[model samples]
Target: MTRSQTTLAADAELTGVAFFTGGDVRVRFRPAPAGTGVLFVRTDLPGEPSVPATIEYALELHRRTGVRRGEAEVQLTEHVLAALAGLRIDNCRVEIDGPELPGLDGSALGFAEALRSTGVRELDAPRKTLRVHRWVRAADGDAEIVARPAEGHGPAAAGLRLEYHLDCGPERPVPPQNFRCEITPERFLEEIAPARTFITADEIPALRAAGYGERVDAADLLVFEPDGTVRGNAPRFPNEPARHKLLDMIGDLALLGCDLHAAVASRKGGHALNRDLCRTLRAAATRGDAPITEAIGVSTDPAAA
Candidate 1:
């Protein structure tokens, strides 16, 4: 009875979620009074069109994740939606102007704070949930995504276990990092969520030249030089880098719009594998497949996706 699992938003609070750093852009999660689920709106536009959290609206670009409805679009929605969905928030509108979301602290912490502070309220109505009914798996070079149901998991989870293998150089301050965790809000915050976004010195020049994460500075994200943090960082949690990878996975997976419930195991999993897993999983669930518990896959010290 084990198959792949598939798993957000609308007025359903005007303030359940909100905007980022750019004063020009406004990003907020508004509740759909009709319980239409959460919808992300871009108020900067004249009409302030909406982008519902669904596969149809998601744009399938490998560079950076984005969502769209007709011509309107929102990019890098993983962080905010991940925090919202992880915190068990199911309804709100996430509105923004610009295409890319601010990299922010590079962690889900900021988004998590907003969702928790505003909070989720249960309606007299029962929430809609997607149950895992099949088995599904997708993979790319050195990356793979698998979804299965929880053994006895509750509604709050779409089981997840993410792994990362970092190969460092002689000059690299970081070592070969690896981490694993059963994805959950508590586990997310404690083990996976706090891990900050990071990039090696080798990539700094390209990032700056490409104008990536412009809203953030070295202090905001963990920019490890050949030595280490330029000045310093919150403190390396040994597995912090791997944990951060998990954080990205959580955020990206949230885009699937279902509470992921499975013994999900990912390796080298970035947005590509993460999003593909969600798509594959959603397809399986939509077709009515049962969820699985223990899955058969390589458990790398730092798993790949």
Candidate 2:
């Protein structure tokens, strides 16, 4: 069965602390017409400039994914975008009164639950879908993300699948973890949405020194100690970090502005490598090329997000 486009049935609001700024932000998700895609409206700005949630508008920042329009930018948007993609929301207006989104529980659960409560309505138009006819890979030193055509399944039968591998080194705080799964709305909520964002215990001081995560604490987010133990929180899954990485990948990939049918594999990949791949895909789509077997070069600089 062909899927129809979707949007919120009604408006919903969520307010909490912005991840980096520690400022209070209220985000309202409102229904939008078909083909609007996802848009971020800055209510705090004088004219409420809107930024399209697409690769063409994505901005490169440290440890986070964001989109900008002129002087307006939204930071730490992965969780909310993940929630929207997990719920299969095709078009909506994400209105916020701040520069960053709230870090509710450091996971996508809150956003997903709020959207579920607001309800989803199928739009009259058919959903937009993208197909990968060949392999495309982007690498940034030890980190890499690859997208390849799904084998065996017909063009209409195949759906998006994510296989993620994470390693912070055996001597590092977090242990090696890997997760592979098909990404469906139900599966995402049940398996991926609750996985919280994490940071190493050693990085806390640097982050605090840089004036970040002011409102976050050990109990509010995951903090892996040097001994591979959580500081104040417990892992929802044995390999929660890997799952969360997949969650971030899904969120970042949503910038494609349409449903995608492909098999993606990532090794120590984060926002930087993901964005690079998105840029390559957008260029390929713009050129209307099929079977783009050419390898897209990845950045060699190390990054974490």
The 0-to-1 C-alpha lDDT of every candidate, in the order given, reads: 0.59, 0.86
- Name the candidate that leads on lDDT: 2
Name the TM-score of candidate 1: 0.77
Write down the worst ten-residue block by lDDT for model 1.
Answer: 296-305
lDDT of 1 by residue, 1-305 (tens): 22222112222122211123233344565554424445677777778877776654677865456788765788767777767666666556666666656555667776676556654556544443444434557787666666554456554443454455554545677666677666656776666666777777787667657655445566666777776654356645877777777777777776655445555666666777777877666555444444432222211111111
Which candidate has the top score in TM-score? 2
Q: How accurate is candidate 2 locally (lDDT)?
A: 0.86
CA error at residue 81 for candidate 1, angstroms: 1.0
Error of 2 at 304 (Å): 32
Q: Backbone clashes per model, in order?
A: 50, 2
CA shift at 284, candidate 2, in angstroms?
0.9
